[model samples]
Target chain A: MKYAFYPGCSLEVNAAAYDLSVKAVAKTLGLELVEVDDWNCCGATEYFSQDELTACAVIARNLALVDPACGQITAPCAACFLNLKKVDRLMSEHPDLDQKINQALAAGGLKYRPGSVQVRHLLEVIYKDVGEEGVKARVKRPLTGLRVAAYYGCQVVRPFKDFDDPEQPTTMDEILKWLGAEVVDYPVKTHCCSGHMTQISEPEAFEMIRRLLYCAQQREADVIACACPMCQLNMDAYQGRVNGFFNTNFNLPILYFTQLLGVAFGLQPRELGFGKELVAAEPVIAAKVGAA
Target chain B: MSVTVKSKRFVDEVIEETPGGHRLRDCIQCGTCGGSCPSGAEMDYTPRKMIALVNAGRREEALSANTMWSCVSCYSCTSRCPHNIPVTDIMYTLKRMAIREGRVKDNDGPALARAFTHYVDKYGRSFEMGLATRYHLLNRPFAAMKMGGMGMAMFLRGRMAFTPSKIRNIGQLQAIINKARELGGAS
Candidate 1:
């Protein structure tokens, strides 16, 4: 399988673990990810609030840059995946917006046709493209004892139920099961992680984070597998603060799904960027999966 | 006559501007949007009430409320809406209108949005450290101090970068942004 990868801005820094693990797992799984050249930020949710047209144009620039050889583009970050897919859908639905965005792109000597490139999330590629049999074939170290709460977050599934059920997604859960991990069927699996809310409003953001942590803990999951950078960052980084605010002693490791996949594929933890998480996924992985 | 005209204008404007705003007319006053919203408790007006305000031409009250600012863009409401109304997109529309009309008082949402976009407009990629520093220092200095320990941990773990990464074709990216800004709304 091949894709035009858009790592987005978070992968460059805060979510570097996700980026590393994605590359490692993809390589091991015989997936080729050719990065789009000079790809800019997808502007996340902020740009849309400021100026909708500008936000679409900014994201469309990336779509315009997608190499013609690769008709499909895949993004690991939920926000990036949503923005790219949403803008493409918008352009396809609204011709006037398409013309306006194309005009903006024309300023930079570029143009993109709506629906030209198929937008996909990394999870979808692994789930649908790789298939269960393919994943089962590559699992050198089965996570028999590991209990993973697969956090879907919002963007990837909601508002665009292209691949998975928006309300009750099972892609990640199925993938984890393929790797021999116990998938926690929690109700809040598809809940919001309060993206960018932590920066704007702490109380609100922490409460949102606390809910997810509390649920995962209640379900007795060893670690929370995240498919989005913001989800992992908020859950892992501010977990201490959430505990402080709520007076709850909750310690859960939040990790990217790719990292766990890499571990199951017999890749080293260091190679998959393990110790980078604030909650420390290493101890849990070692204890449960035996030296991942 | 004037009251009727004003009521029609606000709803029409929202429907025209928002991506899925045309469905605003399809709202059935069901509180499912508010019920499904994760941040509903913090919001001044529930999304259901906001849509009501829009329909009733209570534009000022809807735009001035912290409802839109508190939205996490979760889209739970949008997906769950029985009427298929794009509740999240409507929130974005309200936010844009509020910011444009200078009605977003005492809200960090707009400020954060500005700080985030400032870097995207400059370097084509977000500078997380710079964005956090600028937003927190300007809006919530005490909060910034409180987050110092977390920041230190991130830096130590190589998760936070001091310098922003500039794309190779920044000039081209800027040109597109400027043109888009000039062209204005998608309509």
Candidate 2:
């Protein structure tokens, strides 16, 4: 269960909790992660709006950096996954794009050929490689009937088609179900979290958050599970703003996919870096295990 | 409270013109798109009815419907479309057509479009606060004035960056912009 991992910018800067839980839980599940050596930014999808070739090249340069022997690269950030997957698909199709990108890489004295590695979302590693039977076997704490709302956000399933069912993704649902949690049916699960829209339209972005939080609250989802770092920040850190905007009062904690996985596998909140989160996830965990 | 999404000729030309055209005929009539749409309830035509109307060749009515501008292009509908139609693409095309033909008389979507163009034109990329400020000024003037303190507070608190990342490749982007303008029939 060894993998080449790319934690990306968000993991390092904002979503350290997600990064912590991913590392801790990967070990808990016997996953051996080899973080990519000297990786650059994914440039996110918005970089394409400014310059398409440069965006592709920025991510492709990372693709060029992966160890040729490495079969797969796992990204914890959704935007990073999309960026990596886009360049991977592009490189797979047009060798010329690969050439130009590698030519850019040659500027740094590092060159990578495209299709050198497969880009995977962290959730895939949990469900496919980790296996439900293995997760069920490790569940010292079953999240029985917690009714967690699994939000996929847009980037994970778009353009490159990751392991998640692109249109109607079920990876999170399947994993949560295996962990003995009641996976609630949510329509906006695969919808955009308006990634980086927090930068542009605060009101509109707040409304987007409001809609998701409202729906999740209405369904009484014990917590929302996310794989994207920006989504985690918005849904967790901004839930209070949305509640204030709409005059509703609820904390509505957001959990990274790995954090919940860690908890279900008997990892403690403090070890997984749970309490440090902007939105408290301990109550949800406590309620799940009846420890509260 | 009415939107002037008029001009049947404009609608037909747009639907028959782009790669996104004829997607009208592919509508499965599921309202999942509209139901999930954040601004669905505020529109003259939900994404569902907008597709139906276009498919029915009720071009003038569809064009004039108020649903053209509220989409945030989140790819929710396109991502979920069982019919495989890109609802956002269609909406994008419609918005372009509406502006070019002066079909949409409302300032909402057109204002957002103008704000986006202003962003790309100046910085070669979008700055959220810049767009938010411009969008506020254009569409919600009063909100812009009242929300200045709020925006500035966020700015000081490091929640927003005033400087947008600009590229030296603006000329190159203009070429792609030319290509899209042609594809979108904007020119």
Q: Rate the local accuracy (lDDT) of all candidates.
A: 0.93, 0.70
Which lDDT value does model 1 have at A68? 81
Candidate 1, DockQ to 2 decimals? 0.78
Instruction: Rate residue B44 of model 2 by lDDT.
Output: 86
Off by over 4 Å in 1: B1-8, B185-187
Winning model by lDDT = 1
lDDT of 1 by residue, B62-151 (tens): 899999999999999999999889999999989999998889879989999999999999999999999878999998999999999999
Q: Give the true-structure RMSD of model 1.
A: 2.1
Candidate 1 at residue A61, lDDT?
A: 97
Give the per-residue lDDT of model 1 (tens digit) for A1-292: 7789999999999999999999999998899999999999999999999999999999999999998889999999999999999999999999999999999999999999998999999999999999999899999999999999999999989899879999999999999999999998789999999899999889989989998999999999999998999999999999999989989999999999999899999999889998898998888889988974
CA lDDT, candidate 2, residue B9: 60
Tens digit of lDDT per residue, candidate 2, span A176-244? Answer: 888888888887787666565554456767887887887888888889999888888788766666677
Candidate 2: regions farther than 4 A off: A290-292, B1-73, B77-187
In model 2, the fraction of reference contacts reproduced equals 0.06
